[model samples]
Target: MNVYFLSGLGADKRVFSQLTLDDQFIIHHIEWIKPLKKELLSHYAGRLVAQIDTTQAFQLVGLSFGGIIASELSNIVHPEQIVIISSTPTGVPISKFYRGLVKFLLLSPFAAPLLKSTNSLTYKFFGADTPELKTLLKDILHDTDSKFLKWALIRMSSWERKTRAENLYHIHGSADRLISIKLVKPDVVIEGGGHLMVYAQAKQISAILNKKLKSEEY
Candidate 1:
């Protein structure tokens, strides 16, 4: 099976480096593109459809904001299945408080640098406890484009999708501070897993994927 992966907000393919799947799965990483000013999330997802090889059957795996993008893509392209890790299928789980925060950030001068800075707060929120995980998170944050980050934040905070695909499988962390488990009900929950559990708990996630993806059932 050909599986296309979408990384988190402003993250790259490195986020999925720890995941190991069976040889039968051919993995492809989808790169994020620049969003046009005031572009709708659905429109942005439609633009992304160009990258997918729709001629053949494929599955999707998304993380964080990427999962939201996957949900949008599912509306445009019919994939065999969708596995979202540390993410939600709909934006209903996002708190309205974030919308105000995004507006404030856009107006504040310190917002750009603050969003790019990887500090203890960022670490705590992301649950990057280990030194290696902290470093990786720091690098990812540093490399993220401020404009893109702001754009995604605005779109994500205001997203209003209320439905999900029938073939969608959600995997969430119990301790994820960013997207609290209390907000949404996931198909599978990883104990002690946090926002970065896809990296920290790769072994467990990989095992789950192996079983879930191989099964004939959704």
Candidate 2:
């Protein structure tokens, strides 16, 4: 069976470097493609669909922003199951204060710069704590295309989906700062785990993946 994985915003497959899945499943990491100017996320997902080998049984594992992309892909590829980590298909939550603040920032000339910046403040805020995690985050951010980053922000803010996915499973971090558990009801929660727990808490995540995905016959 083929199991495809997608990384978070401005990230790559390295996000899953620590993950260990069942040997019966072949893992393929879907790399991000450059977005067409002003492209809608659903349309972008359509383009991404071409990369999947959909002739056989497959599953999807997406983290953070990639979770949104995975949800969009489900409308087209119909995976066996899709797992979400630290992401909500419904939409990302923004506090009233941040909403008001972003409304103003969106109009400012520095909005793009803010999105492109990979500074310590932003990394810390995103919960990349350990030196290794911080280094990976910095590298991923540096490698990310500026245009794609800007477009992803727009997609995140404007994403809209109603009704839950029947085959979708969610695994969240109790300590996730980027997406709080208080706002989401996940199928599983990793206590003391942060947004970047995919690396920090890889053992627990692997245990869940192996258990949840192992029994399905391909």
Candidate 3:
């Protein structure tokens, strides 16, 4: 089986480096493309799907923003299995107060300044509490384009998965701060693991994929 892994927002292929899959599967890393000016999430997902070879039997494993992209891509091809890690099928739930604040930022050009000020909060939300993680996060944030950041933030805030496909599986961490675990029904729950569980619990993800693949093959 061929497995395509999609990384989270502002992250690259390195996020899945820790996952060790069996020889039965070939892993492909799908990178994110810059969203076209004023592009919708569905349209962006279509572009992402175009990067894949849809003729083969494959599995999709996505984390965070990639999970949402994978969910949209799943409508284009029927993969043997679809696994979402550390993400929600429905958009992340926003509190009433936060919703207003998000709208204000997304609607104004001052969004970039606001985001810069929240770098520390972003680090904590993504489960990067260590000094090293904080430094790495700062670098990532610095490299990100402000326009793209604003677009992604608005996209995430407006996203809604009204209908889910069958055979969809979710693997989430109970301690996720970015996306609420309560909003999703995960097949597996890793206690104490946070939003970056894809890195912290890669072996467990690989094991789950192995078992699921074996079952499908039989």
For candidate 1, write residues 1-218 as lDDT tens digits.
78899999999999988988998788899999999989999999999999899998889999999999999998899999999999988876546687787778775877889998988999999999999999999999999988889889888889888888769999999999999999889999999999999999999999999887873553
Q: Pick the candidate with the highest TM-score.
A: 1
TM-score of 3: 0.86
- How many residue pairs clash in each candidate at the backbone level? 0, 0, 0
Per-candidate RMSD vs. true structure?
1.6, 2.2, 2.6
Q: CA lDDT of 215 in candidate 1?
A: 37
Clashing pairs in 1: none
What is the TM-score of each predicted model, taking all chains together?
0.95, 0.90, 0.86
| Top candidate when judged by lDDT against the true structure | 1
* Error of model 3, residue 218, in angstroms: 6.9
For model 3 the local lDDT of residue 29 reads 88
Clash count, predicted structure 1: 0
* lDDT assessment of candidate 3: 0.77
Instruction: Kindly list the per-residue Cα lDDT of model 2 for residues 39-130, writing each as its tens digit.
Output: 98989999998889999888999999999999999888899888898888677566667766655665567776677666777776678888
